[model samples]
Target: MDGDIYKIVEQPLSPDAVAASVGDPAAGGVVIFSGIVRNEKDGRPVKYLEYEAHAAMAEAKMREIGAAVRQRWPSVKAVTMLHRIGRLEIGESSVLIAVSAAHRREAFEACQYAIDTLKQRVPVWKKEHFEDGEVWVGLQGG
Candidate 1:
């Protein structure tokens, strides 16, 4: 794709769907990683999470990551990234990254890099709701 294939949705995401979307026979290796909302954060209970995003800017940024992966690893066949918005309960996946490549190494690296960079640079915001209170998390990697 020439433009952003990355999607940030407000509804629940399906990992199998995302994985199937990027599956290619030419690619011998496929790697998928999910960033889940755990029941606890730093030993504290977490009720739910709400994600917000600057749709246009966030998507543009994700496309940049995918393009960069393609450029860095020519063996990579495809890349797909999905992040969830709105209220999410604990144990739900908030983000998913899938990559296919000729070898396992490239797929793993590209997938990891995509998620890491997306968290640092993307215009998405997350609010954590706890029993006591709620707080927005950014650039913290928590």
Candidate 2:
């Protein structure tokens, strides 16, 4: 995880750039996970979202996730993770993760684990904006 990418940005996220960051010559499979701001949540119509994070702590947690992924999947070659802070419109990507591995299975599994763990542990919060109101939510699994 020392060389892995872990970032919290206030700008838009690029899936292609994230994927390229984790590209490895020896990797046979690369998986990218893009978490977007959907138009609705729990049946409520959402107009937008705002993400905030403890920048240093969030990046540290992401690094921990990357290290854990590599430890669990020995074939994982490279990893990249990014979270976007500030306002985001519907359909905008809020998070991007990329994992490169020797096999497709490993890449897919590791990528899944990374995102799940990130949601559970990262120091980030999201506020969903609706026509009626807005609510702040922690980055935790439901």
Candidate 3:
């Protein structure tokens, strides 16, 4: 809602799409953050990652984050938060956040805040699949 794109999808994520969603002719700068699945974690080799979420809740939280960004930085032109669920291979993007604003500083700050707050507040869980085993990652686990 609110004209901002906040979604959880099973399909692969596209950074370009996320960026495009926030494109604004009046905005001077655009900031994007692509959270890619890494090959290694804590010195262990990671084969892939599995992401699961209470989709409705996740999207709601994401929207809240976007709203917060807009509130904190009134100059923000547009904001988007897109996350991909299901299995993701190393080097693939799992999450993408884009922010467009009248200035670079506002775009950068809002984009950073969107992602950091999303990680801490969203109801999404990431499971790391290692060579030896798999583990759920979150505050109670990981």
Candidate 4:
């Protein structure tokens, strides 16, 4: 998936690394957003985060999102998205989004859209480890 939008890796995520990985000269603006494992959520202490995914489907969905972004925003230059798997301690990056566009607005919008769509559509799930226990999220049963 060279041209595809999604990437899954067991290694650590870095903003500068992602920036260097998805560089396009046609774009004057590049935007990157990183979602980190915070110490608290809903006023509860979060110790760590563990992520899992249906790798094949997750990657395909990410590519679809990238294509949709390009189609919706003609000015979009390039897109790069990466999600980490396995256990991550507090303050670690869970998701990274990189977008390049002719202007800032397109980049911002595309990046936001990519992350939002991933959460809603992608088959990735996360388990939050708290001081008391752990709970797996994103599995809304019928």
Candidate 5:
């Protein structure tokens, strides 16, 4: 509740901005994770990607993740999670997560938890577009 940032937006997410949002004076370390769109998947050339989600519910789920992080790692000072929706080209970030804590280990672990939980629990859908065809996949994989 103190320092948690969660959002779902159509615009591109900036790693610097997400990290800045989680910056804290008491925090000794901050870890950021960016999930970007790659050029290929399963040996198939990917043209682009499109993401969609129930924005409000997605943000609420992110807040829940932050709460879980704080509960699991009390040292965590701040958390920020942003997921970008809509058409994204190769190399564009689809998700960004940042965590700040009293130590590097907690920050790293908390960031990992936030991302993994997000993929598993958040109701976001992903569409992979290829030159040949397109496929819809759940956020848990593909």
Candidate 6:
């Protein structure tokens, strides 16, 4: 919606592709954020991460974030938000966000806002698989 690229995919995410999606002639700068799965979390070794989401609702929320960014930073030329679902190995990118704007400040700020809002508002959930067990993130004491 609103000509922004927002989607939830099951395949591995590509930061380059997501960044390219927001390329625009009017944009003087582009900013991208890639959320990667680390080898450890809270001092525990992590085996992998599995992500799930209400696809339709997640996309809708992402679109809302894009709209909010545009409204806050009118200089933004384009925005792209892509999140990968399914099992993800350590070092793999779980989410990618790209924003293009007339200047670097707008691009950077909007990109930051996009990812921050996404984590707090989107319906996506992640399960962290540790060596001994797995726990759904965001649960109490998880």
Clashes of each: 0, 0, 0, 0, 0, 0
lDDT of each: 0.87, 0.94, 0.91, 0.85, 0.93, 0.92
Residues 46-99 of candidate 5 have per-residue lDDT tens digits of 999999999999999999999999999999999999999999999999999999
- Candidate 2 colliding pairs: none
Best by TM-score: 6
Q: Which of the two candidates, 2 or 6, achieves a greater TM-score against the reference?
A: 6
Model 4 agreement with the true structure over 24-141: per-residue lDDT tens digits = 7778899999989899878989989999988888888888998898999888887888988999999899899898889999999989998999889988889988889988875537
**lDDT (10s digit) by residue, model 3, range 43-142:** 8999999999999999999999988888999999999899999999999999999999999999999999999899899999999998788889865453
Q: Tens-digit lDDT track for model 6 on 84-142?
A: 99999999999999999999999999999999999999999999999899999898574
Evaluation by TM-score, superior candidate among 2 and 3: 3
Per-prediction TM-score, please? 0.93, 0.94, 0.95, 0.92, 0.95, 0.96
Instruction: Give me candidate 3's TM-score against the actual structure.
Output: 0.95
How far out, in Å, is residue 130 in model 6? 0.9
lDDT of 6: 0.92
Query: Which of candidates 1 and 6 reaches a greater TM-score?
Result: 6
Candidate 3 CA-lDDT value: 0.91
Candidate no. 5 TM-score:
0.95
- Candidate 5 Cα errors over 4 Å, as ranges: 139-142
Q: Can you write out model 1's per-residue Cα lDDT over 8-110, one digit (the tens) per residue? A: 8887888888778787788898899999998988998999999999988888899999999999998988888888888999889999889989999999999
Instruction: Find the number of clashing residue pairs for candidate 3.
Output: 0
Q: Give me the runs in candidate 2 sitting further than 4 Å from their true place.
A: 138-142
